[model samples]
Target: MYIAFALVLLFIGAEGLVRGSSSLALRAGLSRLMVGLTIVAFGTSSPELVVSVEAALSNQGDISVGNVVGSNIFNIAVILGITALVCPIPVHRQVIKVDAPVALGVALLLVLLLFNQTLSRFEGVLLFSGIVAYTWMSFILARREASPASADNEDILAVTQSRHWGMDIAFILAGLAVLVVGSRLLVEHAVALAGSFGISEAVIGLTIVAAGTSMPELATSLVAAFRKQPDIAIGNIVGSNIFNVLGILGVASVISPMEAPGISALDYGVMIMFSVLLIPLLYTGRRLHRVEGGVLLALYFGYLFLLWPE
Candidate 1:
């Protein structure tokens, strides 16, 4: 019953968030792509940040670390795969040139810092700083690309003018709140279910909690794709992955240093593999085709199959 309710909430939340965030972008003369990369991405990733921070504070270091790593993997492998299958998503040059590399870079950095299985407060600060820098750069880029064609701007303006800024803000906030609540309920129940089967905390965090917390991204991205806003769809996945590693883990570690002995080199390798794979997959035809989507889905399920507890 709770699972069904959470799914409903997640769908509603994703719709409101995508609508409000996209409309806000139109009103501000910014591209929906930029809005997706920043606001929508951060909103969807909030569950990961919250779950990780709480786990860190509770001294569940394995869960905290595993959640971030696993979510990053799921975001690319599953979220993007499903979005692409819904409709072939066009890859923006900015994402190829800037965002994708940044995603890969941060993933590498995280692995390097985690070689000793420890994340210190100082390293956390460094990672946290990356998000601030990335956000600032995005805004700067948004300003440069704010001037969409006059006809496109006019059409967007007509559609958005009826909606007030206050309503847009309300939609974004309410959507985020609902998403977080729904994600929490799902994750709690999922962990309990997994624990009933004797799954370790680290494995539970990596497989169940990670996917549960990422439900928002999956919902929002699929909605964006359905709405024919492919930029938002793609950006939400890439941006969320970046935030999952740099922002979520950074904050969690800063609050309390994390020692993740249960997160093995294989987990980190898989995360990095997904990160690296996105570059060519996106760059190949400048669009992610259904076949490529199938490949991603296969790889992700294969990984999960191998990871499944005996």
Candidate 2:
């Protein structure tokens, strides 16, 4: 019963975090794409980030690593897969030309760092720095692209005028508070529940914990897809993938060095392969039609088949 309640609360908290943060971003004059890419994406991934960091600090390094890697796999293979199945996500040229490459590059960097089976603090810093630099560059590009003829500028100004800046800040702080508290409770209960069932920590991390932390991403992506905002749909996944690799892992490692479990090599290999596989679909000039969406969904199901418990 406690576990069930924890799950409910986890989802509720994630929903609150996403709603508050996305609203705040909109209120702060951010463009829809920027809101989706930065606020929505980061907001959705916050639960995973918090959980991974806490796991690292508590010395449950396997949980930390597994949570990040599993969530990324789930984000692309599961979330995107389901979204595509619902509605074909159109591939924007900007994402194909710019974002997909960055995602691939980061995945490669993660593999290289983990080659020795451990993530050190220095590598963490480098990864985090890269995220910061990428964010700065994104903002600069957005500003440059906003023209006198573009409606985005009007949208930004309207958002800025309608809401009090203080209220926006307050909502952000409150949302974060809820997220941290909710994550702590969920992780504690999840670990305890797994122990009761005699489940390996790694397995718990890979499945239950991973799924729990990914609730926000799942919800946000589903909502975006339903709204027919393909840009947001694609951007959310792309940005979350980057954050999972760089921000979540980076922060966790900095909190404490993480040692990968025996199965991690297999997991990492799969993650890299999936990350790479996404490149072609995203890079193709054409949109992700139903057939392509079907293929991606099939690949995701195959991944799950391989990981399912005996």
Candidate with the greatest TM-score versus the true structure? 2
Clashing residue pairs found in predicted model 2: none
lDDT of candidates 1 onward, in order: 0.79, 0.73
- Per-model RMSD to reference: 3.5, 3.1
Q: How much is 264 displaced in model 2, in angstroms?
A: 2.2
Kindly report which residue stretches of model 2 are placed more than 4 angstroms away from their true locations once superposed: 18-30, 147-162
Regions of candidate 1 where Cα sits further than 4 Å from its true position: 1-33, 147-191
* Backbone Cα, N, C clashes tallied per candidate: 0, 0
> Which pairs clash inside model 1?
none
Would you estimate the TM-scores of all the predictions?
0.84, 0.87
Instruction: Give the per-residue lDDT of model 1 (tens digit) for 109-168.
Output: 999999999999999999999999999998887667656532332332223422688888
User: For model 2, how does the per-residue alpha-carbon lDDT over 1-310 read when each residue is reduced to its tens digit?
Assistant: 6555655566666556666666676666677555655766777787788888888887787788778888877787778788877777777666787887898889889878888878899989998998898888777766766664235323322223225656556656766676677767767777897778776666677777887788777776677567665446677788888888888988888879887763456677778887888888766654665666777668767766666552
The 10 consecutive residues of candidate 2 with the worst lDDT sum are 153-162
**Candidate 1 TM-score versus the reference:** 0.84
lDDT of model 1 at residue 113? 95
